[model samples]
Target: MPNLDDKNAIAFEFARICSLAAVKIMEIYKTDFESRGKDDKSPVTDADELAEEIILAELEKCLPGVPVLAEESFAAGFRPKTDGAFILVDPVDGTKEFINKNGEFTVNIALIENREPTAGCVFAPARERIFVGGDDAWAGTLKAGETVSPDALDPITTRARPSGGMTAVMSRSHADEKTLAFADAQGVVEKVSAGSSLKFCLVAEGSADVYPRFGPTKEWDTGAGHAVLNAAGGCVRMPDGAPFLYAKEEVEYLNGGFVAWGRID
Candidate 1:
């Protein structure tokens, strides 16, 4: 395995891997492909499988023997043992958005150490935007089929909650009554609807102040975004104000209600 102490290298490598997956995802996005339902009734597509295959293969070459808990792999009944450190990957987050052709889906990859996310990358191929966070947080443009260097990334930080009022970004596909209620409770001046982990990126980049998810989610779905938000001076916490943890063996990787805050008061 690569040096786990070198977080910078891990972050950069994850960005590169996610970018490669994005290239292929964009290709599939342009084609007329149909999505099939998984056992849980969630949508899956060729892009999801292909991107995961590419990422898993690259990870094997980059960090051989390190365990990975990837979305597609778990659904396929492959669960690797995880201890102090491991990786969580969501090859395609927001498949509904992808199927809708709304340009909101993302490729997510994250490193978790001691149950906390240490580094991660979220790439929205259709938006041509890639966000990476680890020792540092950055957002950059990514042209389809092109490789980008870490030095080329622009640093990003979360802004303080606006003095006027906070802005909230809600999940477009998964927003439920409870989530809406939470947004309303925040007294946000504006509410934006987005898909995938982009809601976390929006807060990380200061475009929004908070993202409260009250619905069902998995660790893989939130780990990468949590890392980015943390690196950008933000945090994800349970509704009761506890820190969000990963790899909960008892829960089967599922996450409970949590609130992502750009500015923690």
Candidate 2:
């Protein structure tokens, strides 16, 4: 087995898997498909399940014995045992946007070690964007049928917090007064409405200063994006300024409110 600690390699493998899975997702995206709600009333589609199967199979080969915590599988009651080291995946992160044909959804995969997300890949297939991170971070544009190439990517890092009023990216569907109030209190001058884990990518690529989520989320929802943000010199923290860790099986991997931020200075 490859060194599990070699985060960059892991991220690259995830990027490849995301690229391959994206082909399947786009194939489904162009057709008229049906969607239904899971037990939680959240949307699910053929895209989600198929993309998940692709990602899960790839992860098994790349990581070998390490378990995975994937959104669709867990929702289907397939909980795998893990010991602080596992993979996290969200196949279709913006189902509403996807169902609406807005092209904001993503395919996400991450590697977690000791409860910290150490590497990840987030591919917005419809948008032709891909981001991956580990000890380093990269962003690039990719088209259908194209796999990730290191030469095609550019290194990315969060910019220092703007000297002026900050720009905050908030959830397009889940935005509530709490998030707006947080933005207001943070002296935000402008806000960008985004869907899916792309909000976290905005911070990682220095396009936005911060992303605040007040709603409950699953570890798979944030893990990949968190890894990208972290590798780009940013971080995710609890509202109380505590480290945001993962692998919360006790609470079914539900993540509490937290803030993802770029350089403070």
TM agreement with the true structure for every prediction: 0.97, 0.98
User: How big is the positional error of residue 131 in model 2, measured in Å on the Cα after superposition?
Assistant: 0.4
Top TM-score model: 2
Q: Give residue 152's lDDT in candidate 2 (0 to 100).
A: 91
For candidate 1, write residues 1-265 as lDDT tens digits: 4587877678778988998888889889999999999999999999999999999999999988889999999999998887768999999999999999999999999999989999999999999998999888999998755676778889999998888999999999888898888887878889999999999999999999999998999999999999999999999999999989998978789999999999887
lDDT of each: 0.91, 0.91
Evaluate model 1: give its lDDT.
Answer: 0.91
> Tens-digit lDDT track for model 2 on 26-129?
99999999999999999999999999998889878877888988999999999988676899999999899999989999999999888999999999999999
* Predictions: Cα RMSD each: 1.1, 1.0
Model 2 TM-score, all chains together:
0.98
lDDT of 1 at 5: 81
